[model samples]
Target: MADLAQSAERFRVIARGKLADPRIQSAIDSSTDRLRSHRVDAWDELGEVEERRSRAYEIRMRAIRDIDGNLERFRTALEARGGHVAVCATAEEANAYVVDVCKRHGAKLVAKSKSMATEEIGLNEALEAAGVTSVETDLGEYVLQLENEHPVHIVAPAIEKTKEDVARIFSKEEGVEVPPVLEEVTASARRQLRQVFFDADVGVTGANFVVAETGTVVTVTNEGNGRLVASLPKVHVVITGIERVVERLDDLPHLLSLLGRSATGQRLTSYTHLVTGPRREGEEDGPEEIHVVFLENGRRNLLDTKYEEMLACIRCGSCLNVCPVYRKTAGEAYGPVYSGPMGAVLTPLLVGIDQAPSLPHASSLCGACTEACPVKIPLHELLLELRRDLVDEHETSWFERLGFSLWSFAWSTTFGYRLSSALARFGHRWASRFGPGRVWASDRELPAFAKKRFRDSR
Candidate 1:
């Protein structure tokens, strides 16, 4: 987390390091390509995909526009169901509330489903520091937890890990030879986590969408671990961003339609858990108590702002699967929980521009992410907006500012443009050997200018 707050220099260095790792690159390529293909096939089969996307966009944007009202309604409805609601303004506040809950319950072990909000708040570390054992129940997350590594992708945390790597990690942990087979490794993880489910004192998860109308926290999972995490434990805690709340229970199917197809290419995830509240009087296995933590953490600040459309994002990770930069550098280069085009725009906004200035410039402005987004966020446009905001704040370096200023001036008039083009044609070879050009040309070849200009030939 400390590293996430460092300067752009760290991003550059880490990106360079990631670019050099062929093994990691291979893993990322395989996972992203497969996911991308799955999404295409799923959308094709679902017919009227564009209409569904439009409806999803409408649902999300409308919900975000009325976020305050929706949040209040959600609080009221959930509280009416005997659930506890804690609205936290910061990560520290959220963590403290969850920790307090754990302490009140004398909780020694916590089982968690996949939740980026928890990752954003460093919940596991906080719990460990408090002498509470927090285990990730999702298989991919469980693997990354064993390695003490963060998720590389939103849906597939261990996307960069191969079967051999999992076998090695599991074998090392269990003190037995685990085969590098998917079935065997999955069984091994299931065997280990099955006990944790029953023994865990508290269950924690992140809401994919919180229905304000019904006070239901919707979690979409393929592995069904989320169901166990929400039900088996005595106490259940949900931590999520305020933007997740929607105005109606009827809005779910429309949103889920896009989320499922875009995220994993399934019509719907295997387990779409709709938990309204804790156990009822006759319920045999559900949690005795439920707590919902609504984390602001800079999300509300985007309302009525240019970046507010960002809140409409359903976190499908479709942008990552198609992002050229992310496919190459992967998530670690972007730093912490979020990554890819969505992260590039959202991270700096959440953490502040100065904290992650490089993220805004990480994209190629290719617009693939915008096209791929389930809710149509115009992610590339947002990246451009962030870059403009960077210049407005003078956060960019003097050299970059000066260079862009010169380029803008040179290209403003035909005479200046012609003069600059002539100089570039004649001096490109020399320029490629120096300063920024040297760094840019280190891996890519500099194309020679043509002997005859198109204008002159015409």
Candidate 2:
């Protein structure tokens, strides 16, 4: 795994490099712009969008509040339907369980849909280490898999890769001339992946929402690949965060409504599978063995804390689409499986704030992510809380601590405050004469201090 600390330290430099690349900028700009516009249209179509968002938020909150009870109910309901549920408290245990399942099924070729939970636990790397061949069935995931690259976006994994880049990847992998046209490229990928699906002994997927009422694992996808991965293989494994499970079946529609619009701007995904359990005696098509692994990798830690609201996130990439910083740096710069605003709050909390110190400060506190969030997570406020935690722990630099200390002390004293303001005015005037030469001032011009103090004018 990449060292998140090292990656975060170099964030500014990496962002600068990515911003300099016209290809990266163009791809990110166009994709995010289109998604944002579609989301606007989709919300407009759904009359009472805010009301829906509030209802979604309430459902998620209620479910999480009684998470343990919900999980127990979900397990019992799923078991009654002949499905196996494994509650893993750690990533290592989750990966071990999946590997064990694969080994028991004698799985060689494993087809997978786009699963961030699996990525969170490094399941692909674990499977390969255990001598299992895991192939990503999602087109974006397949492209990244072939290139040995991580996802650049949550919903659209290969969002940063251009058609030319994909063509080159295909030509190198398949030993054939592949065109850069979108339709041809997609057809070619489908042709290649169809064989993998046929040969797959086990299929792995992530649930968008798990219904406790019916013991159904719900998955939504634009492509038919998610359906194929779940049904075609003899064995199916679902790895998802515990927060994904909702209490009632009816709660699904509210979340679905939010998820589709917030994620890809569709009223509903092309395919939505509600897998209750393994195939029964009379079943025509389905997996013989269905294993659902509910992963609680640091999620349980946030249950009653100030950060519990983070779990309300539905993994809709809407937050990322509107994040100013994410638009430029993309996902890789965060050095974690999850990225963008959600990642900034999540990765640090999961991996340890010390490991990803710069993540909390990466945002501009513009609240775009808060606005974009389907469940109204208040991501910016959470980020601010994390920053405060860092300061409380004395994790920040001495200079920063001292600067803030001085500011606080000055504000407490009227004379000190007035003197500090006068000094700031004089300094700004003096600095304006030399032009903005500091690195921080490269793109921004420092505003000149007010000609006369407010108090003086009064």
Judging by TM-score against the true structure, name the best candidate. 1
Tens digits of per-residue lDDT, candidate 1, 1-458, equal 22356577877888888899999999999999999999999999988867877888899999999998898899899999999998999888999999999999999999999999999999999999898999999988999898889888888888899999999999998988999999999989988899999999999999999999989999999999999999999999999999998899999997887898899888898999999888999888889999999999989889999999999988899999999999999998888788899989888888898889899988989999998988989899999999999999999889989999999999999999889988888889998899998988987888889988888788
**Hey, what RMSD does candidate 1 come out at?**
1.1
Please report how far candidate 1 places residue 279 from its true position, in Å. Answer: 0.6
lDDT, model 2: 0.89
- RMSD of every candidate to native, in Å, equals 1.1, 2.0
The TM-score values for the models, in the order shown, are 0.98, 0.96
Candidate 2, residue 287: Cα displacement in angstroms equals 0.4
Residue pairs whose backbone atoms clash in candidate 1? none
Model 2, residue 353: displacement in angstroms? 1.0
Give Cα distance to truth, residue 191, candidate 1, Å: 1.6
Whose lDDT is greatest here?
1
- Scanning candidate 2 in windows of ten residues, the lowest lDDT window is 1-10
